[model samples]
Target: MKELNIAVVGATGAVGQEILKVIEERKVPFKSLRMLASSRSAGKEITFMEKTYTVEETTLDAFKGVDVALFAGGPASRAFGRDVQAAGTVVIDNSSTFRLEEDVPLIIPEVNGEAAKNHKGLIASPNCSTTLLVGAINPLHQKAGVKRIIVSTYQAVSGAGAAGLTELEDQSRQILDHKPIHLDVFQHQIAFNLIPHIDVWQEEDYSKEETKVLHETHKILDAPDMAITVTAVRVPVMRSHAESVYVEFENPLSPDEAREILAAAPRVVLQDKPHDNIYPMPITATGSDDIYVGRIRKDLYNDHALNLWACFDQIRKGAATNTVQILELLLEKDWI
Candidate 1:
């Protein structure tokens, strides 16, 4: 494969930083690198591959001569996506802004790699929680035919971006100092409390994050009619995100069979041993690239339903690594 010149938009943000880390850790073959951010962050230096590169203001022209552009920023993609594509750069966006569009492919390479082949210069990464959950569930669903999914998320502050993590840390420090706690990024204090809300509330009372889980899961799995209900909650943890998933399949599957299936799934690690106290935990999963799943058992109330727990580094596998993996696939297929 030929070395490509890559541009990383929103390089100053948490996910963007993780993208750089993954690129370095995996030794992605990039002939050149450019960092782009907002004017406020311009001129800030970010170190990658042992050298410092200053961030420049992101503009349409910034994509010039770039072979691939990774947009980890927010809705700013709307303002610059066309320009990036017009400049002949294939964009892999990590924002929700474009995932649902019919023209753009919402992708998880392991689940639907062929979707990447149809990209019209842009591809989207699914929600962090949705990505991890589907990474584990898709394999099993393919094997046993999933009929329904009931998931409750225990998401980390990092999913809310850097400000979310800072709010949690600062609130904790204030509580430790016996000072008044200030809540900003979230409706309630996230230092020691769990907010049963993520993103905005919709008319049906489900949060945007919950809706993303429902919608993105179907889009990626191509199972639009699949029954899914989600409750997304923000926890005090700084990194990994966890999920309690209850799934009902078309066919009955044993705990051993479930483990055997999940164990062989791509980017999925089965850690289900209750007697040894071995299971997926946020602490153990943080900084790792695979989704860890455990607590496999048949649901007592429903014969075909199974309950499981899953965890993954929200920044890595959920955001950065998934994006990088998509890029790797693009390279392998000569899409870029």
Candidate 2:
């Protein structure tokens, strides 16, 4: 529990801001903190631990003397990851650029914490939807064995970053005012409608976001042969993302038993009760650290298939919290 020097790349973004807040909420022992962002965001001040720190433009030299670098930035990691690692800093990257790399481990401390122990100075956090889904699925897989997974996400606008959220708000205002709607952040208007696509469509007709869920789940669960299919849809919600997950297990499990198992799992909250209108919802899940799972029931057609609803704050547990948790684990193991 020794104090370590910490640096936050993309300190001005939604996820970066959450990382700073979580660091303070968790009272992480840090000897020093440096805020690093793009040149456009340089000179902006961010308050953490009761003091304001000005963000500096990120550069190769940013990692010097830094012990842990939390990267909520995007592909810019391709520009700075190696240099930071070479300088003896552990980079917890929140980007898709490295998650699939064979050498870079995609970690969710509660799931593949042991994999993080072997980090060669870089760890990747999975996609928001993928992270929460696996966080809920791993415990069950260990107990009953997950045979196949089919998921459709009702993702929040914030998953695309702050711009996406703003677009939703602005578009909502426009629609209410009978003004022309601006549909820039998404391929279609997202205010009163759902977009079936989350990211760019690939040759296989799956969006990039859908593909990430498929691959990331396999990697984190260490189940490369697990049957998984995903369809990501962008919803109008501003914060938390929800998923309708249908999982087929090798062994049949009662809903009560699955709830019991998930209740004990780390970072998962079970809120199942259909008749009473009790279930996980995005509005209720926002700003929380745990992923919420509810509406658990058995699928009618498949004997082993179970239906579930999962929700979590996309910017927190989905991104920043998981990254900070990895940092905590790294510190616990003396990896940073």
Candidate 3:
């Protein structure tokens, strides 16, 4: 791969920082790096790969001569995604702004990566929870034709960005010391409690996060009519998101057969050992690139359906790492 000039929009944010780490660890071929954030974060210094680079305010002009720009989930993508692309830079956006657009391909390299080649200078990554869901199920879907999906996500606080993590830590400490807890990042006290709400309410009483899972999965999997329902919940865990998935297939798939398929699936780690009490957990999944799946079993009521648990670092594999992987795909295919 040729070294290309790269730019990162929203560089001061959590996902932005994770993108930097992934870029370094994965050794992305880049000739130059430009850290672009909002005016509030402009002029700040960010050191990556042992070199300090001053952050620049994101602007249309900053994209000149840049080969690829990675947008770290925000209004920045909506504000500058197309203009930057028109300037000849390929954009891999992490926001929902362009995800459902017919022109933009929502990509998970291990899943529907080839769709990225049809990109018209822009591509989108799915929501963190949606990414984990499809990563675990797509392989099985290909083999047995998934007909329905019911998922409940136990998402970590980190999914809410840096504020969520800070709020959880602060509230936990305050509670431990018998002091009143502060509530800001979340709608309710989230230290040791679960909030079954994530994102704004949508049509038919679905939260925005839940709706994203439904719609994005349909698009990415090319199964718009596929039955899917989601219950997205916010948990107190610091990182990673876990999903209890119930999948109904057109053809019957046993737990053992499902494990056999997932065991060989790319970027998916099968940790199914109920007797040993080994399964996917947030603590073990944090900072990891692969999605961990376990607890494979037959659904009690549905003979054609199977149940399983999936977990992955919401910040890494779910957001940052996946964004970079799309870029890597573009580079490997000489599409950029």
Candidate 4:
């Protein structure tokens, strides 16, 4: 692949840092790198692959001569995604701002990579929760035809960004010392509790995060009519997200058949061995690149339904790694 010029927006944020790590680890060929952040973080120095680069404030002309821009989400993406694209850079955005736009493709390379070819200069990455849920099930959906989905997500605090992690650690220590708990990053005490609400409430009383899972899954898998319901819970874990998924397929799909199909699925690792106590968990998946799946079984009440567990490092595979993979796919196929 030819080396191209690359720019990373939100260079000082959580997902931005991981995107650098992934680019280094994956050896993405980039002739030049532009580090961009908000004005508050601008002028700070970051070192990557033995090279020190200065962070610049994102601007209309910031993406000049750049080949691809990997956005780390938040206000930056909403503010400048189209600007960067208009400047002739391919934008792989991690924000929800452009995801639902009719012309923009919501891509999860493992599930709908080919759809990325239809990009009109910008591509949106799915939410981390949606990424984990779809990563484990899209392969099954392909084999047995998913009719409906019921999912409960146990998301890590890091999903909220660095502030979320600090809140958990500080609050845990505060509770241990018997001090007044501080609530900042989250709505409640996230140290020892589970917040059933993630993002804000949307239509039908579902949190915005839960809504993303439902809608993004349909977009990525190209299953617009698929039935999906989600309950998103923010757990106290520092990293990685776990989900308990129940899928009802149009055709009969046994547990053994599901395992066989998932085991061979791309970017998936099957860890099903409950008798010996081996299954997918947040701790095991924290720094891993692959989504871990286990606890496969047939639903007790429904002959057409199957249950399973899935775990993934939301920061890695869900956000950073997936963004980089999209660029990699285009490079390998010479589509960029």
Q: lDDT per prediction?
A: 0.91, 0.90, 0.94, 0.92
Q: List the residue pairs that clash in candidate 1.
A: none
What does candidate 4's lDDT look like per residue over 216-315, in tens digits?
A: 9888888899999999999999989999999999988999999999899989999999998999998899888899999999999998899999999989
Mark the 10 consecutive residues where model 1 has the least summed lDDT.
73-82
Candidate 2 residue-wise lDDT at 165: 90
* Consecutive 10-residue window with the lowest summed lDDT within model 4: 327-336
For candidate 3, write residues 182-202 as lDDT tens digits.
Answer: 889899999989999998999
TM-score of 4: 0.99
lDDT for each residue of candidate 2 in 1-336, tens digit (9 for 90 to 100): 889999999999988999999999988899999999999999999887789899999998877889889999676688898778877888899988889898889999989999987788889999998997898888889988999999999999998888999999999999999999988888999999999998788868999999999899889889999998898999899999999999999998878889999999888999887788889998889889998999988888887879998999999999999999999998888876
Q: What is the lDDT of residue 254 in candidate 1?
A: 86
Superposed model 3: Cα runs more than 4 Å off:
none
lDDT at position 36, candidate 3: 99
Q: CA lDDT of 334 in candidate 2?
A: 85
Q: List the residue pairs that clash in candidate 3.
A: none
Between prediction 1 and prediction 2, which has the larger lDDT? Answer: 1
